[model samples]
Target chain A: MALIELRGVSKIYHLGGEEIRALDNVDLDINPGEFISIIGPSGSGKSTLMHILGCLDSPSKGSIKLDGMEIGSASARELARIRNQKIGFVFQFFNLLPKLNVLQNVELPMVYAGCSSRERRERAMDALRLVEMDNRAKHRPMQLSGGQQQRAAIARALVNSPKIVFADEPTGNLDSHTGETILKLFHDLSLKGSTIALVTHDPEIAAVTPRKIEIRDGKISKNVDAKLSGQHDGPKFAVGSQQN
Target chain B: MSLLNAILVGLREIWAHKFRSLLTMLGIILGVSSLIAMSAIVKGMEHGMKEAMIALGGLDKVLTREAPVPTWQSHLSDQARGRTMRDVEALQRSAPLIRMVSPEMALERVTISRGDKRTRPSEFVGVWPVVIEMNLHNLEHGRFFNDVDEANAHAVIVIGTAIRDDLFGSPEQLGREVIPIGERVQINGQTFTIVGMFEHYESDQDRKKREWAREHPDEAAQKQAVARGRPGYGGGGSRSGWAFDRKNRTVYCPMNTMWLRFRAASGTGNVPDPTLTDIDFKVEDLSQMEDALQQAKNVLLTTHNGIEDFSFSTQEGNIESVDQAIRNARMSGGIISAISLLVGGIGIMNIMLASITERVREIGIRKAIGATFLDVFTQILVEAVVIAIIGGLAGLVAANLLVRFLASLSPTGNTPIVTFEAMAMAFGFSVAIGVLAGLFPAFKAAKLNPIQALRYE
Candidate 1:
């Protein structure tokens, strides 16, 4: 069974007495251990679909299930709990709280999860170690470079071990070399069986994932699976050892 | 989030903007300190007023004075015989509730003289030895009149220090203590020997001032010289000091001596008016004052042939006035302080609103990490309350300093007392203000949409 299933999901908004449909009858499924990318231009409703899938918002009309639990019609509080336990998001700006150090930033998810401080500390350190950011745990986000900040943000996203992780233009703020390194890190995480969906406007970044879902004009335009098509030529970047 | 974490976050937030937080807390600090300081001043005033009340005898003392007959008994007004020794004897013999009765025969406008010095005593009363206890007098030197003095009408007198100061010389001027025992003086052209002299009566503040002057004579002399050069300087003493001054200007002689030597010679038809000037008594228990007054009234009624011409006046009226003044002072002070505190709360609310606005992006980040509305709300509320708590503590310290400064500024004024109850109440008010101030801002922050907040920039 799919880890997340969305059928006929729609999000509507009203502005100046005019109805605007941001999402219209979207149907999609994401299985466990699948690396996928949702790609589209701005105003194509792909961001709205990511928001609904991430549980930051509820669908106006649809049946949406995550890990076999229906959540499309859940209350705000219930949706927050689902978001805390079952999902994680990585924003383009590396949204680590500036006042907190990297370790404290990573522990924030479990802080809301109501985990014991001891458990949160241990899990947060482990997540930092996985991203090779354990050494920078005590440093604030402002002190770190763009790549390091994004790496720390990734550690925060994985600290709770959610069922799905959504990266929204994670490398959009970094230079090309740093962006390549972050994409390689994502690929390595996928190889280790983590379900990550990269949402971006760049086709080059989306090509790193084996499966791609493209959306345009409030509807899905294409859903392609390179592994199933037996045409999985890996990302254009050279496959090399991890670099810090 | 757990409350502990929220508080930690709140504290960190305050620490991040220490200057702003301190400025925000300044209002609360001023408010709380003013509240405590205001109460302390009122408390000091109450203490001084109560002291003056006690100086005028005590709460248990009641005066029996002559009053006109009621309108219903107007036709019988001519039959009224004023308070006299007969009523005093009757109350002493029949009224068990009346502990002691002192009959006073006052010679109004009486002048005492020695050599060329002449001074008018505030009160020239002829009384029994019980007058000392009735008036709470402290006879520091010489002997009071004995039964022989009253029975034989001895020409002896007991005078307060004020009269002696005028007759001979004040100890302050003579640079030594003076005991005028056995000194010959004349009262209204009648020779009398001073038998006793009561101590100088003065308020605690006045006593302190005198002692301070005695210790620092040079400074006192300089200040006095400066005051002499400037009119109205040190001329107006404390309002309550008049009570002490009046007590010090009294002169007492034997009851028969005042009647036989003074009133007897000045009465109508050459017959001495047998009426006593004043009849004062003390009750056994203050709580049973009404019943005791009633008992004395019943006894006096029998002696006066049911004339109903005299009435009772308890010290309770004076005490009630003092209490009313204290209550009025406290109410006005409390209102002013509470207004400042509310203004302080508004200051906090204004800052909290601005703070949340500045942290919109932060709020969005926190909400995106699965923080519920309650968590955000508690975080903001805790921050405001923490500011208040800190401000309240600082205010207590400030109040202590303020009170001390005031005491030093007027060392002779009533010393302001800072009570623990005032501190606790001020602190409690500040915290309550903090909560009220934080509510709107917390609600606004917590109700923010995560997406819109992220886009707030």
Candidate 2:
């Protein structure tokens, strides 16, 4: 079974008495150890798809399967358990609990998941080491540089050893140099047997991921391989090369 | 939640805005203080009144006096002077249901002289042994007259403590002899010997009884020197107005002896007409006293051909009425205090509700983090109760201090005694107020929905 699967997934929100379809029967599959990026414009439903795949929100009329286990139809507690145990989220804004230091912020998932203090501390330290943020563990987010804060957020997401990492515009708030550095870390995580799903609009940010899926007008419109360094052939694209 | 965690949470929240929390606690503090102060004041008054009642010789007693208010009046003709020995007999028969009832005859205007060391108008109370015990009197010396004196019509007397000091100036005059101011030299011509003396209230009544023997030292000296023989030259005479204020004073002689000497030689055989008043009677229980007095009155009224001039009285109802009034005042004061506390409790409830609204977000977070609603509710309620309990203790101290300060400045200059009942009730009521004050806040906290609460901005 695929590690991440979306079956006829769609999201329709009733906002102010108007039906807004954020996803239109989106179907997708990606295997373990795949580094994937879903890229699109602001209203192209790419962020909505990321939210659904990350378990932060559920699709209105579809099933989400993670590791051959159905999660979309599970109870609220079960959903929260899946979020804590199977999914790790990295946001462009770096939503760190401001009161906690680098080490404490990284320990949040384990704390919520009821890990023992000693294990949580050791695992958080290991995650920070993997992100090259172990030296800055005692500094709060406000005290750290932009790249260091993002790295700390990565440690928090990875501290629970989740099955998948879902990052939405992870480098959107960083300079190109820091953004390149973060993309390299994601590549390294994927190489080390972790599945990575990232969402970004920057072609440079997307180019590092091995697989790319595009969303437009609440539907999948573009599919390509960023690792292949190939072009997109579409209604709105100029093809450098085409892939069958 | 752990108790420590809950208490810490309460303390931390309260400390976050000290001014607001302290203001909220004021309502409970005021309520407790008022209850304590009110109870203390009423308790003090009750104590003072009881002491005064006892001083009037009727704290828990009932003495039968000629009532109808006119019984003790002088203008009722000399015919209504006192009672016959038959009245005493009837009183002794009908009176029960109490501890002691000793007949008393008190006289004033009696003079005493010991080798020109004179005491004029000395007050004397003639009492049977039981009557002395009825007053809870602790004697300094001597004993009371026994039944033998009554059977023999002996001329023996018991005197007040004040009179004893005035006549002898010392208690060592216990075995000495003295005389009463009267021409009953041998009391209807029966020679009497001075036996014992006793002390009652602030002086030696026992010594004064010895002084009654001293009034006729010549009769006593001759009797002691000679053996028992009927060869003594002493005479008995009729009653003399100069010897006593018969209307106001009572001289306790045995009823048999009183009738033998003072009863008129009237035509009634079984009992010398009871109308010929000389012997007086007293009853034991205050409740039974009125009936005993009424029986005597009925007997007299029937014998006196329905002359309504005579009266009977018992201090029973008057003293008890005052006691009941004090009790009623205490109850009303307590109720008023309770109402004020309730008003204050409502104020506390309102303030707690406001606090709950203010901390809505914190409550939501705590609940979302696996804290049961009971945990949140109990934490808030415990906070309110703690504030009240602290205030109650402070109020107790304050009330006691106020009682002491006010007692010192009282116009009557009597010591104020605050009873234990009033203090205990005040403390208990303050605690109850704490529990009552928390009810609304607890319910509000418990009823909060986690979803809605988390959504509260």
Question: In order of the candidates, what TM-score does chain B achieve?
Answer: 0.80, 0.56
Candidate 2 chain B weakest ten by summed lDDT: B233-242
Candidate 2 on B232-319: residue-level lDDT in tens?
2112112222222221122244544544554434335745443432233445444566565666667656544455555554555666
Which lDDT value does model 1 have at B154? 93
Write candidate 1's Cα lDDT for A4-74 as tens digits.
99999989999999988889999999999999999999999988999999988888898999999999888
Q: In model 1 chain A, which range of ten residues has the least summed lDDT? A: A235-244
Chain B of candidate 1 vs. true chain B, TM: 0.80
Please give the CA lDDT of all the candidate structures: 0.90, 0.65
Best by DockQ: 1
Interface RMSD of each: 0.8, 6.4
* lDDT digits (tens) for residues A40-135 of candidate 2: 889989978977786656789988899999877775456556777888878777767555688977876775566776988899999999998999
Q: Which docking category, incorrect, acceptable, medium or high, applies to candidate 2? A: incorrect
Q: State residue B280's C-alpha deviation in candidate 1, in Å.
A: 2.3
Query: What lDDT score is found at residue A184 in candidate 2?
Result: 77
Best-fitting candidate, scored by TM-score: 1
Q: Pick the candidate with the highest lDDT.
A: 1
